[model samples]
Target chain A: MLSRNQIKYIQSLHQKKYRQQHGAFLVEGAKSVQEVFQSDFQIEMLVATEAFYKENTRLTDRQRTPVEIASVADLERIGTLESNNAALAVVRTKENLPLLAGPDEIALILDDIRDPGNLGTILRIADWYGVRKILCSETTADVYNPKVISASKGSFTRVNWWYGDVAQFLSQLGDGVAVYGAFLNGEDVHTLPFGTSGYLVMGNESNGIGPAVEPFVIKRVTIPSYGGAESLNVGIATAVLLDNWRRTGNLT
Target chain B: MLSRNQIKYIQSLHQKKYRQQHGAFLVEGAKSVQEVFQSDFQIEMLVATEAFYKENTRLTDRQRTPVEIASVADLERIGTLESNNAALAVVRTKENLPLLAGPDEIALILDDIRDPGNLGTILRIADWYGVRKILCSETTADVYNPKVISASKGSFTRVNWWYGDVAQFLSQLGDGVAVYGAFLNGEDVHTLPFGTSGYLVMGNESNGIGPAVEPFVIKRVTIPSYGGAESLNVGIATAVLLDNWRRTGNLT
Candidate 1:
């Protein structure tokens, strides 16, 4: 049975302030809960339906922390999802990593990407492309948004994210590293000479790269479109751009 | 003013059966409404706030049919959106295209794509890539889903979609066309030599290419992942594959 106060506390985590105060966030759904449980993040509590306990024995057996079996109604009461099912786990937030850049690593820098789903999908792309770090402007969506977490599917565990003023960070990086931006008209992505170590910048959905970040870019790259789309979705464009860079740069 | 009957009529379009029975569908928001007005599709009704009419003279000016200006609250009453937007236009349903394929054109065939957003985004991609037609299995999400209409943005105006059994269609196509399925362990996308004409089959989000569609594929293509992401979002993956094929295939 879930106490009213417990339910209130769980609901509060939906807000960033409450998450910051408690240093934890909710991970719901059986797959997401399992992923969080297996990750290095610290788990605060695990609540599940009786059926969930019986079905997810592997998840329960592997828990190094305390686990609780609750009724479906209790799980539903605390779950952020519209249709509550299997489980919900409260896990401590991952520590914020200091911004780090090396001379020979491919990186992604997001400039005020406001959509949490797009951000999460980008993180998943970065993970797939083997990008170790994604640097975002402070204005970007919170990486912990439940929508972002759900969209990421599990790639958050492998990709490190750091937030700062991207313009300042790019300016400070040494001369050998390349900075690429996706522009409407630029070098054809197929023909661009992508080096192994560089930063690819994707801007806000509506506006392209902001003026502040524009000055630091070494080359503007674009995927040539033959059709009528005004713009590709930020997430889809990210994947296309990254796939090309890795393929042409032979980063893999 | 929207009567109770009128509001119910608009809301019922949310269902596929109602949309089909009425031979029309709702298109929402300023951009989408403007696109439909500019297209050849017949507009059955136009519902908008006074401010929307003031701001978008182009929408009101382009109308060859009767236009209805309702209060924002009236628009809200008949609108399907959560926040309630400025305009909603009901477009006469597009005529089903004849089931025909050219010997040399790229076509996307969705097996069981359930997400409206993915389907809409894919339609936008097809439009952007100059893919003129998309064939959907009857099991795929209805193209008129509000989420689909929103995600497709304005591309639905240009691309043609047909519904049929994807497996049967693939089996009937001659050897000149390359029927490709996106699979996990298939040939690396970068290494594959692709052709201009054929069916590009994308499968269910979680299960991937269905068993029925799998047997009909003459070739299997895979986007090589360099990192730990188990899979890409179906929509993003579709763009990457389509983009690569257009860039490297005989189409170029």
Candidate 2:
């Protein structure tokens, strides 16, 4: 049985302030909790239903993390997902170290993306396309948000993210590294001469790339629209752009 | 001011049974309500704040749509959106008649896409890529669901959809029209020889193309994964596939 204090503490982690103060975040639902064990993040504890605990005892023991068997109701009460019958985990937040493009690697830059679901979907998309590092603008939705984690479908474990000033990061990029930004009026992504390695930046949902970051973009690319859609969703735009990037043999 | 009976009537349309019985659905939020006026849909009634009504008097007058001046609170209570400060409209749902591809026109087939948001997002993506007609399986989420309408961000105004047995529809497809189905193990979408005009079939969110619909696929396509991520969201996959289709000069 979870003590009231324990349940309150877990619930507190749902907000940014408590999460930052405790240096921990939540991984909820069956798939995400299972995958978090495969990640390098430090696990603080796990709360799971008896059925889930019995099924995953070996995985739980292998991680050497404390596990508390609880009812599905308990799990739902402490987590963000509408229906979580499996488990929830409290994981230590990783240090926000700097990440750069390795040779022949494409790094993603997210500029002021405010939606947690969009952020999570992008993480999954980036992971599918082999983008290991994501540079997020500080204004972007918190990577640790449960909504983002839930939407990521456990991809948060595989992708590394760093939050900072994206404009500064772009300005300091090494010579010969190109920067591709998605824009309404830009070079058609299908025909653009993508470099061997660079950064592809996506902008906010309502606005394109902010002025602070626009100047540093070496080339602007567009997934040419053929119909009446005013804009594509940011996550959808990211997948299409990354797909074209990999399709052009830019992926290593 | 909305009558108590009228407010209760709008709230009833939130459910599938009521929506079908009433033969009407809601279009909420500033953008969607504004765009619905441009669509061919019959406007039953529009509820708007006094400010919105004053600013859009010409537009409200153009369609001869009945208008009810309401507060934001009334709109929030009557609509599904958490925050709809501007307007909401009661739109007549279209007939689910048959829709087939035109010459050199691409059609979309959705097999059991269950998520309302995913269905709605797919509509927006299809609009962006110029895919006009969408054929949905009977099990797919209703296109008129408010969540779908809200997530579609006004694209429902442009795209046409038909609901029926997709398997039967595909089987009865005219000769020589190719049907491309997305699969994890299939021809790489990047290099697939897309036909001039055909159907791109997207499967359910979790199960992928249903067994009933799978046999109708003339060719299977995949957005090749380069990383450890297992799958892409259905909407993301749709965008990538359509992007490749358009990139290959198949969009006429």
Candidate 3:
């Protein structure tokens, strides 16, 4: 059972301002909440249906986190997801760790990916491709948004993400670190020689790479389109590029 | 100006039963509405702000469709999209054209892709990759769903989609036409040789290729995952497989 104030507090985390103010955000749905529960992220509150609570008795018993048994109506009232009848959790947002791209690792640099779903899907893609870190422009969608967390399908627990000025971050990279920027008229990615470690910069959904980060791109690569569609979705484009990198790059 | 009856009617089309009864589905937002306006699909009604109406003078003048000047509030009230301030069109869903897999063309076969957004994104990917036709399971998300139309980003206009039994359709395909189905433990796609034209089967989001359609697949291919992530989204997997086909297949 949730009190009025508890429900209000959970609802407030839906907004970015409130999430930042409270230093927490929502991880909604059964799959995401279950994944976060097993992850290292600290949980503040776990609101779940009787079924979910009963299914995970061991974790619920071990954790000192406050657990609230919620009805489907209560979850719909406080949670962000439309079909969240299972569970919702309030998780403490971790501080962005000071991390740098390693010499032999691939990282994704997102330049103003605005859609929360796209951002989340990209994180899942990164996790699938073994790309550890994602550097995002400050303009990118909030990682802690409920939509992002839900769309990520639990991969959010593995991928480390940080947001900063894309240009400044790219400039600070080690000398000779190849920066592959996705472009409309670049070298064919199928044939391009990709280094083992590099930052693959993907741009805004509508606009390609912005002018600010374009100069830092040492190599430009493009996925050759065979059809008449103007562009691929940014998330789809990222997965294709990452697949090519794994296939042809030194990392393989 | 939109009448209260017209508003209620438009809102009703949001449901599958009403859309079938009315034989129309909404194409919302300026980009999608503009694309559908120019497509072969007949438009029953064009609901637009004065701004959109004034800008698209040629389309409005030529078409016999009823034009309703609607406030942003009316569009928001009736449309499925949260940010549909520009335009919405009531488009008559076209009859499924009888299509067959050509000897020199690739096609996508979706097996119960349940998410409207995934179905829409797959359509866009198909359009981009030049895959002209898609054969979907009868259980697949409705192509005429407003969410599918919105997520397709106007690519729905180009891709031809059909719904039917997966096994029956595959059994009827011409001999020597390869069928590439995405699987977890299939051949590594990087080294796999692909034919010019074939059916690429993508399965449901969670369950993957259904058991009913598994027997019809000639070749099983998978995007080799380098990370610890469990699986790629069905939509992302489709793009990667299409990318590989374009690169290695005889089509290119």
* Ten residues in sequence with the least summed lDDT for candidate 1 chain A: A59-68
TM-score of each: 0.94, 0.97, 0.91
Give the per-residue lDDT of model 2 (tens digit) for B225-244.
98878999999999999999
lDDT of 3 at A75: 91
Question: Per-residue lDDT tens digits of candidate 3, residues B1-252?
Answer: 788898898999999999989888999999998888778889989999999999997976677788988889888988988887799998898786657878779989999999999999999999989999999999999999998998899999999988889779888877777888999999999888888887999999989989999989999998898886898988899999999898886324
DockQ agreement of candidate 3 with the native complex: 0.78
Full-model lDDT, candidate 2: 0.92
Assess each prediction's global lDDT (C-alpha) against the native: 0.84, 0.92, 0.89
Predicted chain A of candidate 3: TM-score:
0.97
Q: Pick the candidate with the highest lDDT.
A: 2
A best-first ranking of the candidates according to their lDDT comes to 2, 3, 1
**Model 2 complex DockQ against the native:** 0.88
Off by over 4 Å in 1: A54-63, B1-5, B54-63, B250-252
Task: Write one digit per residue (lDDT tens) for candidate 1, span B1-252.
Answer: 666777888888888899999998989888888888778788888788777777877656776555678876776667677655679987888877745557668889888999998999998988878888889988999998888888898999888889878888888877667888999989898878888777799999888888988999889999999898899988999999998898786336
Q: List the residue pairs that clash in candidate 3.
A: none
- Candidate chain B TM-scores, in order: 0.93, 0.98, 0.97
DockQ of each: 0.86, 0.88, 0.78
